[model samples]
Target: MTTSSLEPSEIDLTDWDFWARPLSERREAFRALRQLPRPAFFREPEQSIMPTGPGYYALVRHADIVEASRRPQDFCSGKGAINITDMPPDLNEYFGSMINMDDPRHAKIRRIVSRAFSPRMIQRFEDQVQAVADQIIEEITAKGSGDFVADVAARLPLKIICDMMGIPESGYKTVFDNSNIILGGGDAEFLPENDEEYALKLLQAGQTLKDLVEELGRHRRENPSDDLVSALVTANIDGESLTDQELGSFFILLVVAGNETTRNAIAHGLKLFTVHPDQRELLLADFEARLPGAVEEIVRYASPVIWMRRTATRDTELNGQEFKAGDKLLLYYWSGNRDESVFTDPDKFDITRDPNPHIGFGGPGPHFCLGAHLARREIGVMFRELFRHVPGIRSTAPPDRLLSSFINGIKRLPYEL
Candidate 1:
């Protein structure tokens, strides 16, 4: 419990080493991170004020991330949501989502969503996912080759979420476009610029999702169906149902969560396979047995949900380092995934990495990712179909990483499907 045993000055938040290099050069960065004198998570990278105007400390060590994630009380979620953009202060209360709440409120919202992603709820989607995967692969295979990002990863998740919400086929593109605008707003291909233009684009995206949620809520209210929107419309929480604002925020969470993360996971998963072709062939050869491990490896390698933010509720010591009340902490899950202390040969994509404790979907805590099962199901199915039908689903062009340091990932992976 000696506080400065691990000096705060030793950490480097801007870790340009791994982040600066292209994808092909990232392994060296991970290797270098492994050789650092102390635990990388405990390393203090440069601190900067966020666009939202809050100051935060970024945590990179595996143990520290696990501790922060598990201790949601002293470290609260309300510090901010996963993104850095400022939520208009006046509208903050309404945007109070499960991802942005602490303790009881966070648990409450999670329970409501759990209803939609429970064992029974998720089971219903298995056949649907396989079917969609089959049809899409059939088209891609016939064409012989195409950009996997466009031909596959970007297509399936929205369709699945829309089906779950009973949304019409036409709404898929709008939902997809809006998520890209909000989540990848800083990515040049997605939104182009990071000035006021990007902020305006995010507001526009929020308005679109807000409008869709309102209309969907109204429809479900009038003529209830077996879809999630309908189920939520009639859902009672502590004998009280979701109000319009609650309904809107929850719906936005579902659609955004259901789509973006899964898409990134799949796209990034495929890229990992391309980089580690040996592992790719190994999974394809014994797919049924190796597929689950392959999924874990991809999640570990990609770490799609790069980081999640927390606010310090009280003056405390994390890993024996002092932090003041109201200080922001950015828990870098990406670094945790590659922690050498946890995995032998952490940089290599081994489909056989047993005891894979990667924090891709996050770990034990109040805000652990709820959509993990669905993500695994979706990514597993997509890879299965890609290997089976696409023959050689490897990248044909160099992949482009999204510009935003948050939720960092590939923007375009031009693969020959």
Candidate 2:
């Protein structure tokens, strides 16, 4: 239900080339959208299509996104959380997990999973994170140079999350390979020849993940251990526990959403350090004092997961624009994090920037990232390890970014340590 508000020529969100552009160009496009008074309607292109149930409104402003996320009752997520598309309810259930849920079910699953991250567990994960960061750096530096994504960035979170899930070392590559393809959008390296092949490829990857979780869930249920899967399988909230499907779905979410994001952020952190060496020096000068803020700044700047979707439950108006029941909206965190009204010199990557108010972890809402605490620790530890050990490390070439509007990921980053 687009109105006079939309200026179609301004941009096309559905274009593949748009997503493949350099970071600067992409940010500029989003920055331009922020000036509009209302969210713009986007029509998903037909040729390179997705199963987007309804057209989506691009919510680019900080205020609008914050409002939509806060008012989850108005803008729901039960249909699906990916902007511009909606998966079938059953598929969304398995893949989207609690992220695609609303209210009772969302709360129920979150409560059970939340228990897995008790303070003691977070402390333990933090200790293990530091160890993994040191090990990754030790391994990478030993090679003198390596692809930062595989050698360094991807390893820490992959190791930590797999360790937490009790996934054996033999299966690390399986998890890693599947996740990359799942989130790769339509990148040729990951995606196949056509839509039919792509669907099969995605299904194969997804099935592999599900099989792993089911196998692990069965083992953990009988031989319960201190791992997250065991905690989840045995968890009880209000006399209800996660069903095998729910447990498997949640595990899928943790592996894909959990590992993919932090991995990209750490990769981006290294690239950012090389690009803005002064920012690196600021952190290097007083690693302890600046580390926390640096992590926030990096997340704000990188915004690993770009946008999340919300479906309108009923007719509503935001920023003076009318939205009908069932209208889909995308909360573009990347744009909101860079909104000029909120951030002073928003383009500048300032490690000392306080009152950040970034939506890197989604905005203040029920759906904020569950692994944010652990992610921050991982990013902080990795940088601490990098600066301390590989003092002269720098990216030798521009990153080969994954062709994804959804995930702000670097597929390959060449570096010299």
For candidate 1, the TM-score is 0.88
Cα error, residue 333 of model 1, in Å, equals 0.7
Q: How well is each residue in 1-417 modelled by candidate 1, as lDDT tens digits?
A: 122232344334454443544644443443454455444433333323223344456576788889988888888877565644445542443343677776676677677667656566678887799999998888877776666677788788888988888889888888888877767734567774446665567678777877887798898899988888888778776876667777777666767776877888898888778878888889878999999998888888888877877777899888777777977777778878878888888778899999999998876797777778888999999988888876577887777777666666666788675
Best by TM-score: 2
lDDT of 1 at 154: 78
Which pairs clash inside model 2? 52-85
Off by over 4 Å in 2: 1-10, 47-54
| Cα distance off (Å), candidate 2, residue 355 | 1.5
**Cα-based lDDT at residue 285, candidate 2:** 89
lDDT of 2 by residue, 208-305 (tens): 99899889999988999888888888888889998988977887888998799999998998888888989988888898999999999999999999
Per-model CA lDDT versus the true structure: 0.73, 0.86
